[model samples]
Target: MNPEVNEDKSSLYNKVVEGKAQVYFHKTKNEVFYNPIQEFNRDLSISVMNTYSNVNNNKKLKILEALAASGIRSMRYALEIENIEEILANDFDQKAVDLIEENKKLNKVESLVKSNCDDATLLMNSMSRNWKSKFDCIDLDPYGTPAAFLDSAIRAIRSGGLLLITATDAGVLCGNGADTCFTKYGSVSLRTPACHELALRILLQSINSHAARYSKYIVPVLSLSIDFYFRIFVLVYDGQMKAKESINDIGFFHVCPECHTFYQQNYGKTVPTRGNVKFVFDSTSPYDLNKCQNCEGTLKLVGPVWTGKLHDKIFIQHLLKYLNTKTTDDFKTRERMIGMCNLAYEELDNPLYYILDDICSVMHCETPNHNVMRSAIMNCNYQVSYSHCAKNSIKTNAPSEVLWDILKRWVELKPVKEKWMGPEYRLARILKTQPKIQVDFSIRSDCTPESKKNNLLRYQEPPPFWGPGSKPKRKAEDEENSKQQNEKNQKVIEELK
Candidate 1:
């Protein structure tokens, strides 16, 4: 296959990634192209698709890559996955469509993959008009937020079909850009250690809200916050009752600004009731004041986000089993996948997580080993599990006081570090006088084990001089060199002609 020329007269580079799929993309000074960092994202998507197919007994699955730049992801799906009937790789840019077609032929997947040039939302909406034309799976991996495409995507997928959505707007979803998040997602995001988890929930909430408009609801099979983006795989279900019922999962959080204590309150859920017993929900009264019970500090109310389970344990188990059966050259990614799935599988279906570093800092003490903290919490009969959001964080059912008590005990055993002593005078004083609680410091079997090796899958270092922040400028000498190289490539193409 020949390389295509971009509008700037730059020749595209045809390269192979993940040891199998070949992609044609431009890597010039002015062109934006493929990112190697998302290899793990693509890898996980393939695995999820394979597992979903197996579990659902799906055959002849049709997929739509809504934002298929260069068609690498679509091509990868066709080449790597089984039981794929067809893949429509669509991009708004004609240049991208040309590259997608070239890559499709290069991979010899012309029969299985089709390339289209159209606005993603328009294409999906048009396809949704036909009852039989909806795809079995629609992958919306846009460059930024996927919110704009969620409505069309939901309409374009068949009932019980999978919708794989990627949101790279971490800043907005993770609370860095709170106003933007609320404006786009209709939810407030908390800037806390557990913000990544919140980010996943916020995205899900957005998807759920959009689906509800069409009397459809989503069941999140797996949700991941990896690197600079969040990916969620959900199965769409159609039913007015089910859609309305799913609204119970949408709620807001009251988070303490001082101590980071947070709690969720679901909308239309007022009084507590027994199992299988229905109670009248009072919508007239407002939710209790956003006040911290522990610190008496005014809590910051954030969200109207998804308060349901992020990952289906059964689905993750199936994914792990699927991973066990497969082998790949990207061992790092595979290992990280295993580790992350394990963590996600066991994580408490809790809303927010407590960062050990933050907890220790609050107590004016050196951070104890995570295992030690886990053991301390578990000794108190509180369930504790590792968080995928942060390394030193744990999702637990323990109350704030209990966690602080554990930290207090640790400080008594090992006095606060000198540097940490002066600023937190109140904490230091309390720690020095607080009675030591007798708790076994031994690591418990339930404590999450540290990965034996580094998992570089989540965040991979970008190639030198490649990033959105700073573009590499061509030097006076490098410009001449690039011009000569372009001329040489053009001459080669002419010779072939």
Candidate 2:
């Protein structure tokens, strides 16, 4: 068969991306193809893989991309990363399989990367049954929730192997679809300013619960919330002691509907164990409140989510080091990734974050500068750092009461011009009697100009027709624009050569 004839028959086009691999994908519709916006996601994945490989010192690494769409990820891994023994790229759709085969050949990695057509779950289960713990890395980047494939994928990975999972069902995980989250992830989610962080925790909790059933446990090396989804890289191990320790990380939350004061309760800690393996509850601790402490309003219970450290500090440092040593042009999101790594490295291991806007809104005062708030919190001898989940959020170890007191003091310094009436009057009356505390109003230099430069790299304006929804069917103009961009990139590559 003539290659040009075959390509013409399917109306497929070849595009080289990230300076690494050339892939064949449909132009008019992305329903059965690739999404260019996910380049950051892929870049980070490669960096993590490189770091993990170096840390393990594995000379022959095996990888599995369970839901490989057009085999771009697998091809990139084969071309860009080192020490790869094999890559099994699987997709259930025959058309996708055909494209994967063609792309695999196009990239000249047919000997290293293999394409298979089968249901992802069944394929993973078969691998487990045939060769248990065979893969050094297993990637599950399904279209939506990866919950369905977690069980099988966990069983198929070698002990100490990395498991990469992505969940795009932010609506459910972020609490917009509470019932759906409970049904799928076996946890309750709350839609709050920190919902993105909560979403990451919820996904971790679900993975832990599933791994526990097979005497396995996961230690999250890196957990991040990026555009449109959340991704986690965890190292899975097998041991009774490890599984028991994993149980200790399982916990719940108590959020006040009125003031948004949130509390966390771990299973074995706050929820004490009784003689018959039952829980002993006490009013003074975990079950301490039926009403909001600040406003005397009802408190809603929110979790059973993971309350462990989201990112391993040392691992993040290593990832940054690896990126720094590489001179490859494929990592287009390098600066943005450095910014994210810097934040993750410094962020406190606290469970939840506080939104500055939310805090000021509650206090009925103008929003204070983030640096001022940070300085004030630090003056009180509490740790604070910027949260990667949101731009105006900070994760601090300061108690809610202390935070409220700081806000109350700020309000006193600069009184609200709006007349005090109704809830505002009630709040002012309540805050006036609180103990007065002095705060340093000096500006903080936590984030430097260099850090801002790194962050600015990730802030590209979206396309004119961008909106929130599933990946849309590309129109003719979209395809033409993409083709032009590809040509321009190729010309740049030629010039460099």
Candidate 3:
């Protein structure tokens, strides 16, 4: 036979007769369907499994994969992870279920995998009643939004269950379709340069919000951008208040134009800047800045941008505590986990505020209300305020994601900064003179003697009112004007009386 013909025949046999894909991944061998995309996902799934194995305490784990396209991820988890005690794998397609059964037997994991053909939503609803506290981990790797199946997935996951979610619609979360994002995900999108990081934060917050309905606390253990998708590994611990607190950690960006600098603050703390400084209180918005501070030249905002740090050193340390355990089997898996843990620990700090703000803004715009945006702005360690109309021009002279990048010099504002006594004192003096600005001073807090004295010295406070004797009376021309005013008042009083 000709060499070319022979090669073609072999390729045909491997694909058609032998039932194999391009890559022969461990625990993924079977007699049927294959996909390279699924292959990559399986690799990721196995890594997660190996990590779970290190922490399993020999307890029975119930794992459910809602949408098993080729049963690749389910198959790998079932066959490889020793810690996985039981799995209930479901696929809506009957043919897919058949392949799942075959793969189960081929991998000798049939005893562990219980394959079924049913809509994931239906299965999740049915499981809600009987499967309460049943599953130890629930993985949802869907084709797109995962929004249609999200409520059910939230319900199916056992409290304290691991919910591994993957969102492939990067464009939507990254601010391409701001309206759609708000409509579907209940959030807004701000396309900043650090858009990917913003994408992750928005996704995490959306997941947290969705999970909150089921009384779950989602602690993000791992988050990464992979294969045109965003994946997050969150541990769903049981707690109402803790979950509320977790959701409240979202932050916002306040951009400043004067200094070509943006002020980033959170929602939870007091609003740092005043409401009106020459008719504009915020001096910032969620948008990017146009000018450079130092040279006045327009600068660029480059991103994948993460404003907060990626990981907590203490959290990384806690994860590493399980590294030397005997339960973990694969060296490669161990290395990946350790690397992720370290990156999260070492690089994660400052909470990625720039990215967090954009994320929340994107998500906020997507949602029907400003709840998520408000929550994020309300709870951050700093302060944030909302605007009804565009306060500044949206046109940025620099890269759209410029502010998404970390500032060259970050001034950590002191928590105990003094209040703005200048404005308050000026207003107080004005109130004393006019007394009829229709303003109320009862809401104003008393200033310290030193603060009051300082304002007096700084020319911030107007001179105090003095008796008429302290200054010459009005001039003859002014007296004539006063007499005319008195005559007018007498006429109006006489008419009323």
lDDT agreement of model 3 with the native: 0.50
**Model 1 agreement with the true structure over 1-497: per-residue lDDT tens digits:** 22434333234464756546877666654343667777778889998998999998856689999989778889889988888989999988776787777777778999999988899999999999876889999999887789899999999999989999988888889888899999889998878778999999999999999999999999999898877778999999888877877767777788876667676677764344675534344434243455565445587878888998898999999998998887767333786677778777767887779887886666667687877888888998888876677777778888766776777678778887677666345454444445435666788776654442333243234356432222223253577899999999999999999
lDDT per residue (tens digit) for residues 193-225 in model 2: 888998999999999888888888899999988
- Highest TM-score: give the candidate number: 2
Candidate 2 Cα outliers beyond 4 Å, as residue runs = 1-10, 14-16, 28-30, 130-133, 270-287, 421-433, 444-497
* Pairs in steric clash, model 2: none
Estimate every model's Cα lDDT from 0 to 1: 0.78, 0.79, 0.50
**Which consecutive 10 residues in model 3 have the weakest lDDT in total?**
405-414
Scored by Cα lDDT, where does model 2 land?
A: 0.79
Per-residue lDDT for 194-228 in model 3, tens only?
45556776676677777777677677666765436
